[model samples]
Target: MRIRNSVIVITGAASGVGRATALHFARHRVSLVLASRRVEALEALVAECQALGSRAIAVPTDTSEYDDVRQLASRAVQEYGRIDIWVNNAAVSFFSPFLAVPMADFRRVIDVNVMGYVHGARVALERMQDQGAGVVVNVASIVGAVPQPYTSAYSVSKAAVRALGVSLGSELGLDRQKHIHVCTVLPPTIDTPFFQHAANYTGRRAVAMPPVYSPERVAKAILRLAERPRHELVVGRLGRSMVRQHRLMPGRMEKVMAHQVENTHLSKKQAADPSSGNLYAPSLDPATAQVTGGWKGRRRSARRTLAGAALLGVGVVVLADRLRTART
Candidate 1:
């Protein structure tokens, strides 16, 4: 469990939460196998980790391919003589109505988000079974626990992750082959290029959610979990509240969410590629703190969203009869 000199394999290490966690583990002197399709970024991350005095390798892995995942495990074992921990962190997102989202995007999302994690868990379990101990960590989202509008595919993929974690954890508990453990970490929106990199079915991207937690906060939690494995951990009070509210009142929650989406919708605007797609340049390292100026800007935008939604919902309710009559 000690990260110091422990061997760990992480997927999607090119950016975002994966990048942050890789650096955090490196700082703790953990040996690392960092994987992603972005060879440039992965190499940079590997160099960073090595500079911190940890043995590391950068593997260009496409998690959607089962063979690629298998090779990832084999390469790590070949280099380190064993695998200790495997983290499934690669994922993609789409924002739009389910009916409008393209089939290609849907399939790709499933291939990367759901099946990728499944592959990691499967390979990690096999190696752990051989060694008599190991750990597997999955990075799901708050969406795994609570569904939201404009992210049907994204929500479904995360929900699948939640289901897999619980079921696999139960199996690992009883398998008797080793002390292998499965742990899931769910974090709210973080200040990452993820939103910028995500695809949009509606042809536009909404401004990211405010109060986004820094990736370092999530990384710190992962470090803690490594020391003491929990079945699951949810990050941040905001994420926990949303999950609780949805459970407490589904209908009211639906209405509130519907109003918010309608009022703050950016579906009409032209979409731009997310910066995280920029696999070049010095990547955004694990930030220790959130930028205050950026935080305030996002807060103001969020307030306008709330106030506008309340007004729009009231207007729609009052004008319902007139609008229906006109339709006839």
Candidate 2:
């Protein structure tokens, strides 16, 4: 579908990948409806989009609430005659051992990450069905496919998001709704404020792991999916490789991922106090509203890329040897 002059709604537009996506679409001749809990940040983003020569509005929304999502959809149609694309990108994460995390925090992560996307999809699909054409791009994490340690709730919510995309696509297929498409994007560690904004119960600080891709990269991938809908897209090469390895050796991959998360995903030296970061309330810090989290750089990317390649190469060789032994 042509992006120009189309009406696009993006959730979590205040920061991270969502913010980057909004700015990206703003370059095209598209009307944007930006949603987020941070009213000030959304307003700022709206001005930026407008400056880029796009028609845009800021809608302060809590996507976990069905009524809020419904109003968001209504507002989009009220502003623009029709909805063309809906991006389900609003999500929150918590880093903690399963037993250590409070039940409330765990539920909040599910509510915002899983139920938030559900609310957006429900409202977006209904409106799109009426129009007979639309696209829903769900931003899930690679952890959805290859679960990591210390983030059980986040992992579960992302996996549910992936499942939601599959079920919706199948239902649409059965109903012959060929024009309305649902696409799921799975990104690995991304250089976004997501790590800083996450609720952390682990004693160590949460960090964007090695080989972290820039938010802009993920944003570009989201734009591509919106223009040409695909069922599933992994944003990074390392992420795609990890997913394939997990599929080939689930048991071994789980152990490897656990180790990776423990050593790299969380800071080993930096201690952090337990706090519910942006789970219930919007982040007050202006710094958290930017697209990049200062984790991506040429030197870091190159080093991490080499490390990841070596690890994947060893895994491939081990898997090949196992296959040969089994054949013998």
Best by TM-score: 2
lDDT of 2 by residue, 166-281 (tens): 99999999999999999999998888899899999899999888877888888899999988999999987788888988888888888878878888888989999999899999
TM-score of each: 0.81, 0.97
Q: What is the C-alpha lDDT of each candidate?
A: 0.75, 0.91
Per-residue lDDT value at 2 in model 1: 68
lDDT of 1 by residue, 164-219 (tens): 98999888767654467888899866766676556665666565554367777788
Model 2: lDDT equals 0.91
Model 2: runs farther than 4 Å from truth? 297-299
The list of candidate 1 runs beyond 4 A from truth reads: 176-178, 257-328
